[model samples]
Target: MATGQDTLWEKFIQPLFGFLIDREALKELSDSIDWETESDRLKNPDLIYPEYYKSQNFHGIKGGYLNSSAAVTYDPITKHALPPNENWNREAVIKAVTGNPLKIIDLGCGTGSTTIMLKQAFPNAEVVGLDLSPQMLVMAEYKTQLERLNVQWLHGLAEATSFDDSEFDLVTASLLFHETPTAISQAVLKEGFRLLKPGGQVIILDGHQKTLRNTTWLTDIFEEPYIEEYAKGSVDAWLGKAGFTQVLTEDVWWTNQLSTGVKSISNL
Candidate 1:
């Protein structure tokens, strides 16, 4: 079933998001950034700043604007289609954490796609979407209004979420890990663990750098400046050290993977 989903994602969704949407947005966003100069600095021995670890506003504006445009252009059909199969994984995460309904938090939820999807899947559960970009939050809010989904949108950082501890039944992130620094990534994981209720689950859908195997050439070709390093990062180890149990990591696509961990019920 997962394999069939992956095939559909690659054959259909990937092209739609990557070529139809992401490529143009990424190109414009990259051009707006000083990638060449930053690339040079990254090659320097003393330059410790990671090349891709930037929190600039242009990324927010460009991404938010493009996503908003995409949202508006796609209208009802496109708006409904944004979640992709990752939403299916989110449903599985909800089932894994609690047999019935569960409150879910979507960290780094861009444009509120995952957040709305969660609401659709579990209408009874409270859903919160947190992001660092205010512009993105606006776009998310717009989408939520269009769908009439009752979701709370918050402008917050993943590394230092404002929510109280043990507040959520499940915490989820999709396509977010690879864009953050190692330190920030660890901090986000810790925050996720802190936010979950006892027996709550943390489900992350992101790239699986370790699973590239035979597609090294294509992987490298398609991967951006930070892809290689992000792929090599030890997210599973970070989650384990953060006091999560039942840590599970699995390959999903040419680059995508799903990693999850559970907060023990005793700790809740």
Candidate 2:
């Protein structure tokens, strides 16, 4: 599972993206970038966020969401990290959520990978993507604009957002929970519940916490600060406690799982 790209991700790219960043990022992939401007461009001044969102580097990436270098490398790194299966793994998430969705929101959507796929799958839907990382959102914005996909980008926290209550028809979070502490993960679930309308469903795709089927290699190569708590915990129970019902969880790939829960009418 170790791609031996550790140097490329951690050390070598560090000096490149951190200090010697090139002003123009689109022309060359290897150039270091000023992520602060990228972040400010996508950031919302009024949205409130918890401390945990700012403190940890969940993926061993420097500056976490604030690094422009990390943002550009994220998509390619993940694709190579999971290889051929990575493409379909995201597709499984979209497929798991059934019915036609009119309004959709993707949480922790990094570099617009899942966000783009979501728009492609449901072209007519008004899709919005939110991420803590403005650098990632900048990359997402660049991507969506290039593809001409009308996906909306936002800078906000998933656990707490400025959106109205029960505003979305379907809410989805991909590869988010494992990066966060268990407490924050639960808060995110509660937030998802609060955002969904009565009977609206929420979809979550993340690392397989329950099954130790084939994760040894993943741990060897990657650095995930909160993945252990996520794998051992019960997202199903969290959703239940958040007042969601009709919950279902399924394994999508060796490293991923997709879970869906309908917002309970009783909770309404």
C-alpha TM-score for every candidate: 0.67, 0.85
lDDT of 2 at 2: 29
Q: Which has the greatest lDDT?
A: 2
Task: Give the number of colliding residue pairs in candidate 2.
Answer: 3
Residue 233, model 1: lDDT of 80
Candidate 2 lDDT tens digits, 68-172: 767876775576555357888888878877788888999888888998988999999999999987878988988888898999999888888788999988999
Question: For candidate 1, what's the RMSD?
Answer: 10.1
Candidate 1: tens digits of C-alpha lDDT, residues 1-268: 1232334445555465554554565456435544334333322233233233342212112232223333333223233232455455445544444454467899988767767877887899889988654445665776777798889877567777768988888898876776676677888999999998888888887766576444444333333334445666877898898889888887664456778888997655
Candidate 2 overall lDDT versus native: 0.77
